[model samples]
Target: MDSALAVRALDESTWAAFAELVEANNGVWGGCWCVGFHVKLGKGRTAAQNRAEKEQRVRDGETHAALVFDGDRCLGWCQFGSPDELPEIKSRRLYEKGLTTLPDWRITCFFTGKGLRGRGVADAALGGAIAEISRLGGGVVEGYPEETDDRKVSGSFLHTGPMAAFEKHGFTRTRPISPHRWVVTRTVA
Candidate 1:
């Protein structure tokens, strides 16, 4: 069997697939719709309200993420955008230390479905995300993959992805901001 991957912008036509990926793997990130790190964090807003706000971002062409697909099926997702584009990240307790606002594109989170875990889906998504950002005219792409001594960390908190996973895709940790988070970045050349 062949596995051809396609990465695209999150738009109206792709909304359902995006929603399906979140719903099908609620345990992965609690049916987040991938907005917790972009809209819900520290906002004190209900999930529904956060979802609504995030949906408006997509509609307003202000989305900072992309969904990954294996052919016609949505299998993974990556959240990337300018720091200013993501309110949740900016509002986090570690925001100042975890992120650097230097006109860079940030990859704050990633989620691949249960059946697709450990299958290089995240790597493919990362590559595709790089290409997406590069095609839009090259900028620094940053990630904050969680580092754990135990490999058994659950996907819910592993949304940042594994540090090894990011390293495999050319991301290098510039600094360690916390015990669980490290700031990683790749400057497109």
Candidate 2:
């Protein structure tokens, strides 16, 4: 971890910083505002609409994220929420097919700054999420990370994070959801 890295929960006061980071990254996967997995997929929504929805969700305290910062600059974030809060997953059908128990929290997405990729920012965000969840009360924290050991992968496809990172944090692979994605989890204490 970077000694200068700091992590904070996303709240009203920190919303601006989060927004700035997303905007700098070209609205994050085409103006997603990090809400693609939070809500149902809808068509004909513009980037502005998505931004407005995300802002409202933040104001309403409906969104959860571990925001990573380097001094005054927002570098990255890890998104998490309850199953009800984030009902949709990338491979929903496959994940649900093997679902037996619901997790207390789910890590849905991760993002680092454009030029700051592979700089341990995502690790800081993951640690922050675990710490925040533990502070709230420890429970089973789930994550969906891609297993890309055999071939090289791009940073964009690794938005959910690499499986090795989750494993380093003591998250065990529960099941394989897709060809390269697996459901990994850890009990925060």
Best by lDDT: 2
lDDT of 1 by residue, 1-189 (tens): 126777777777787787677667753344456676665455455556656766787888788566788877888878888767754552256647544465478887788887887666777777777887887787887787888777577777777778987888888888776777777888875
Q: How many residue pairs clash in each candidate?
A: 0, 0
Top-TM-score structure, candidate number: 2
What TM value does model 2 have? 0.97
C-alpha TM-scores of all predictions: 0.84, 0.97
Can you write out model 2's per-residue Cα lDDT over 20-52, one digit (the tens) per residue? 999999899888889888877589877898889
lDDT measured at residue 111 in model 2 versus the true structure, 0 to 100: 96
Residue 15 of model 2, lDDT score: 94
Candidate lDDT scores, in order, read 0.72, 0.91
Score residue 44 of candidate 1 by CA lDDT. Answer: 57
